[model samples]
Target: MMVGRDVQFAVDKKPCEVGKPILEVEDLVVPSKVHKNNAVRGVSFNVRAGEIVCVAGIDGNGQSELIYGITGLEKPTSGTIRLEGRDITNAPIRERSKAGMSHIPEDRHKHGLVLDYTLADNMVLQRYWQPEFQNHGFIKKNAVLQYAERLIKQYDVRSGQGPATIARSMSGGNQQKAIIAREVDKDPQLLVAVQPTRGLDVGAIEYIHKQIVAERDKGRAVLLVSLELDEVMNLSDRILVIYEGEIVGEFDPKKTTVEELGLYMAGAKKQGEAKA
Candidate 1:
């Protein structure tokens, strides 16, 4: 949200600092098949710059579709996806990336990393075709290596062979950190941080959370989609619950009770009072 005057609640009492939303999703619908029924229907919300919006659902309730639709991995059947008031409803993945969007997928190994490539190569995976990493049609080895050194050092990515280490060789936590480092280093306007601390131990989870909030403090919008209820309650400024392909509830972390949210997450009942 961008207009400072639009913030209606006091920060001392509210979870969010209101403004014109950095990310506005309206009537967002995603159907699984070309002619199939909707996987996500009428899902909409606003993620203000410097805000962390979490979608907390158990699983199989269109959480994946919500993320995919927003990131251009899947096109919305009907919706307007806006960033900074610009309608980007039909933009391709690359176009979305250039416009400042980053997704840390739920399946990090499958959708995030290139196992065969070295950490350095994979760090620039999404942007390998760009001029900074390319000379003519070849990769600029020095530039990539330099950038990799900076990120690996900055993110504290530990691997047996350091920055030049192969992706498959590093531990899972380190590998995840590499992907995070690469994307976060880009200073994206909106970050789709899907389970940022999924498989990590307590220490790694703490580190990742700090990194996430740090990004928010720098005025970037973060959409955190996670099944871990504790993480959802802890990191999000606002939490949204998706049930049966629709958003059932929205709550401010400071005022809402997670125990009440647990009922909605378990699909026991719909929460109709809180609307995004």
Candidate 2:
């Protein structure tokens, strides 16, 4: 018999009124592996503060490339990307992060964590240069340890060795939690979460969902890319369906059905022009 709290997909809290767009992408066209084709074709959208906007599509419909363009993993062939009205289409990854963008990348192992590093070390990977964690070109070990412990406790990131545990030794859920805790703690203006709950158990998914919603309620703009329709519906205020590298339809989750979304995702239907 099961003996655990029921998983709740919906958070009881709602965000404050949505604010102006913090992330603006216009005519984003990422080049594909082949020289002639664009992987992301003229994708345009804006994510407002205090709202969750989801890019919903089947796997391999240019979702990965789209995220790459946004997060600086790949430069777009042509487009403009703005953060708080400043153009950053060709900015370096670190510059984007410094501009208040935190990315919970889709492939945790590939882009999220340094498996060989201790949990505490990985916790401050993006933040070590700050005065709090570094002084006189040296790491503040005690401060880092204290900070890591606090986040692990708050986020319930379980590991046998605590902060000293090598990230590779932890389970997938714990690793994901570590990433989320680190990213969310930064208090970014824009949180780009790509497949945040992929491969996690129900309990872990529940916890992560709550964290994302909590961020939204705190007035952070969230750009979520996911293949799961239920996650897209439950967590998003707005959904943009991407098919064949273009946005085919935009829907308000409260007003659209899964069937309608699927039709757009499958290329069976499309709106005349998907508004941002």
Candidate 3:
């Protein structure tokens, strides 16, 4: 639900609190042996049930590093990360995934999907090892196809061959759609969406935005990291502006200006760097 400039009298002032478990990061820090500096100086934030918190900032300022740190791709040097109150900071990547945290990496072509697999197969890749799509430790082909078809239609993937299409042959937009459709459909307690709408056309961007909001509406906690200024400004109920690997500002869209947001995003300003 988007609101205009005078958004106070808007609908649904109450935020959603359902879908999945809550995600909270406390004083997260990442060190760099290469640069001899903290890549993420000290970052902390929260993604509550049914809320989308967008991390807005310029690139080379640790935007990419932050998402990687959260997903266990890059182990943090310090701090605690919790999903539904379980400390996951030191947990391995697979553990985080099993804990119901799904991450759509920034480079979807490289990390989000497997080019060798068919779209339908890639859609259920996260769960192939699980029992729902498998029976007696054997993959149920028809059940897999059914699950993939449902997500493709629901998220609007429009390849000519539909869910059976090879991921390598799909258009960029369709690839993104397929990944989003799969990851979101998995219905994780915490969703790490990194630059999800980048390289997507306006229509695809719009569709993805609605889906993210829909997740929040359904009470899923989403940690969104995007370079699109308009996307972050429009979709985030609360904004966390990251600069130099640390969160520098926090604002309620109902109480902040885009210009003000730009300052924190660009490192021209830093409102506060308090603990979460």
Candidate 4:
């Protein structure tokens, strides 16, 4: 059994109604770049405010493609992605960010951080162009530094030279922390955290888990795409098992066993198939 440490950060947990979905993906399809078949086929789901919905399956089951489609990193072949009832299927990356979406991408090196940039600069990669951090097409260096300092402290992000350290020089866990700090601090309506705790130490994993839970408690919808069953079982309120480019079954984490979930993830059982 895995044990989680006490959460150090203070977050207000309030009751939030699970009515009215905040994000909806209907009949989504994503074609593979290197293959003839679609990467994701007719996938559909809705994430409500104040809930942590996890997409759980083995690696290479199209989970990454699904996230890419939703985050606008890759255009979908067909179907609609609605955020707060607004169709943003074909919106650009910045537009999705402006539409209240924050993503902790699966590949931190490629999608999360600018390795050559200083820690402070990477901290504001998504928001540096905003009015708060820029004026007259010039970045407000001091403001950016201050903001980075605050996040580093709040999220326990460590680096060799504080905010001046090069991002590539930081450890993986610290890099992940910086990404989380930037994304979560934005207070986005929907947070797409794909493998947020992929390769972190136990302490870091515990802290990230708390942060995710804290987000859900604050009435923000979190779409967690993780292959770790422990994280799926511990952090999510609902589980979606995706297999062969499709969702095979949905379950309440509290009501489903890992063994049963494993069966669905392996394509041994499906939503309508009879249980033996």
- Each candidate's TM vs. the true structure? 0.89, 0.95, 0.87, 0.93
lDDT (tens digit, per residue) of candidate 4 on 1-276: 233555433323344457569899999999998789999999999999999899999998999999999999999999999999999999999999999999999999999999999999999999999999999999999999999999989999989899999999999999999999999999999999999988887767877888888888888999999998988987888899999999999999779999999999999889987768
Candidate 2: RMSD to truth: 2.5
Q: Global lDDT of each model?
A: 0.83, 0.93, 0.81, 0.91
Give the lDDT of residue 65 in candidate 4: 94
Q: For every candidate structure, what is the RMSD over all alpha carbons to the true structure, in angstroms?
A: 7.5, 2.5, 5.2, 3.1
lDDT of 2 at 95: 93
Question: Highest TM-score: which candidate?
Answer: 2
Q: How many pairs of residues collide in each model? A: 8, 0, 3, 0
Ordering by lDDT: 2, 4, 1, 3
Off by over 4 Å in 4: 1-17, 274-276
Q: What does candidate 2's lDDT look like per residue over 1-276, in tens digits?
A: 131878776655574569989999999999887556788999999999999999999998899999999999998999999999989999999999999999999999999999999999989988999999999999999999999999999999999999999999999999999999999999899999999999998889989999998999888999999999989989899999999899989999989999999999999898994556
Candidate 3, overall lDDT?
Answer: 0.81
Superior by lDDT: candidate 1 or candidate 2: 2
Which prediction has more favorable TM-score, 2 or 3? 2
Rank by TM-score (best first): 2, 4, 1, 3
In model 3, residue pairs whose N, Cα or C atoms come closer than 3 Å (at least 3 residues apart or on different chains), thus clashing, are 19-219, 50-219, 50-220
